[model samples]
Target: MTRARRALIDLSSTSYYHLIARCVRRAFLCGDDKYTGKNFDHRRRWLVERIKLLSSVFAIEIAAYAIMSNHYHLVVKVNRQQALKWSNNEVICRWYKLYRGTPIIDRYLRGEELIEEEQLLVTELIEKWRARLFDISWYMKNLNEFIAKRANKEDGCTGKYWEGRYKSQALLDDAALLSCMAYVDLNPIRANMANKLEDSDFTSIQERIKQLQSNNVYVKSEITHQVKQPKSLKPFGIRDHARTLPFSLLDYLKLVEWTGHHIHTEKNRHILKGTPNILKLLKIGGATWLEVIKNYSNHYGHFVGSKTVLRAHAAKNDVSWYKGVG
Candidate 1:
């Protein structure tokens, strides 16, 4: 059975979610089409810019992302509290950037005076919009819809751009979060699109690498870039803030490098050996962690985590099963 979005997204349990959106008919709409020799690679830049712009407006923070030929992956953290803190006027102003908003909101923004009743009505509307500003559904909707419209206009044709509703997987624990982040960051390498981390364009890994190099914090074979984290995406941290990722930039780089080497070797060798210390610190075994980073969606369902955490989440949602888990 297809579960409802409400059932899948439970912010109280976890705010991090892995989202995937693919092009219609699985076409290479955002990359170079070998068959047609059409260079659509520029479209990826459009997506990255739009996503970042939307992130700036919404309370959602992007933790990791990878823009591929026909699809894109994102790990995002929702900050409901941040949205709740905004004033009614501030909410209206922010929403107006994406949409014209209701007539009442328009008038309010135009500096037109409102009566006591009218002010009350506008406040009601602002309240709803405020909630939407923090909503993942609304955020994804605005993102896809805007991109679709722009693409259609550019293509001089109208039809479906995205295949369907974006697929989402909730990260039930830190293990799931870390695994999914690496999976997304290493997608280009896995697909053979790029052979190196810095070569992986339109990915968060490359973005972070560029930032580190620019600041001179990352020198040859040294992890001096511990203090600096990507500003656009969520910072990788231990406990500086509750919203940050559960590891530092240096730790993540090491883990990714180790994972990339193993993945490349595994292509030729069926078995993998050795363990990354970071995984040990997180209490995740090498083989299990490799399985997760290689095939996250196949190994887990709507909720990704250990059996214990999965069971707890299923019980909380009153679900008899989640992708065949009790």
Candidate 2:
């Protein structure tokens, strides 16, 4: 049965989530079409650019992503606290970037006084928009809808472009987060589209590698302040006063590289390579970690975590049971 998104997503349980959306009928809509012999690789660029653009406007941060031919994966962290801290004007300014506001809002921005009722309405609208700024549903909706419209126009047809509502799974612990990120980053290699991490185009791992190699710093025209890390993707490092992934960036890169090697080897042959140190820190057996990343979708439903954490979340949500408990 299809459950309501609210029932599935509990922010108090966790802020990080793994999301997936597929092309309609599992067609090669974003890659080279084998049936028609036409290339649609440009569509992948469209999705990547839109994802980054929305991340800047919304309070969501992109932790990892991979754009495949028929589907895409995203591991994002919803920064609700950041959204709450935005002033009313700042909220409106951010909202205006994606949508046009009412005349009252324009006048308000122009320094013209609004009537008491108009001011109240403005307050109500701002509150609603503020909530949406950090909402995953709204973020994905904006992303999928924009691409659907543009792709439809180019294809000269008017119908559904996406399969359905994007699927989401809450990451209840560091184990789940780490495993899911590796799974997403290694998608191309698993699918046999790329043999190595560097060849994994349109994947966050590739982008991070390129940025590090070239010593590039992303700057946005609208952002007045400077950020030391890549602006589009979240920074990976030990958690401290500033928000970041719970692992070091170099360690993560090594982990991904190590995992990619194992993935390429024949299944029956056991390679004598040692596991990356990050796996030891996370307390995950390297063989177990490889299985989880290889079959991530089969292991979990709406929530992914240890058996204890999954049971607790299920009880809190008033459900009899949850998947991925084993």
For model 2, residues 1-326, the per-residue Cα lDDT tens digits are 99999987788889999999998954476888878787888999999999999999999999999999989999999999999999999999899999989888888889898889989988899999999999999999999999999988988788899998999999999888988999999999999999978899999998887766565532112211222456799988674625888877777877888887887784757663787778888788888888888788898999999889999999998888999886
Looking at model 1, residue 6 earns an lDDT score of: 87
Which 10 consecutive residues of model 1 have the lowest summed lDDT?
218-227
Q: Mark the regions of model 2 whose C-alpha exceeds 4 Å error after superposition.
A: 216-228
Candidate 2, residue 68: lDDT: 96
Per-candidate TM equals: 0.93, 0.94
Clashes of 2: 0
In candidate 1, stretches whose alpha carbon ends up further than 4 angstroms from where it belongs are 109-113, 219-226, 267-274, 324-326
Q: Cα deviation in Å at residue 112, candidate 1?
A: 5.0
lDDT (Cα, tens digit) per residue for candidate 1, span 286-315: 887786778766777878887888887788
Residue-level error in angstroms, candidate 2, position 33: 0.9
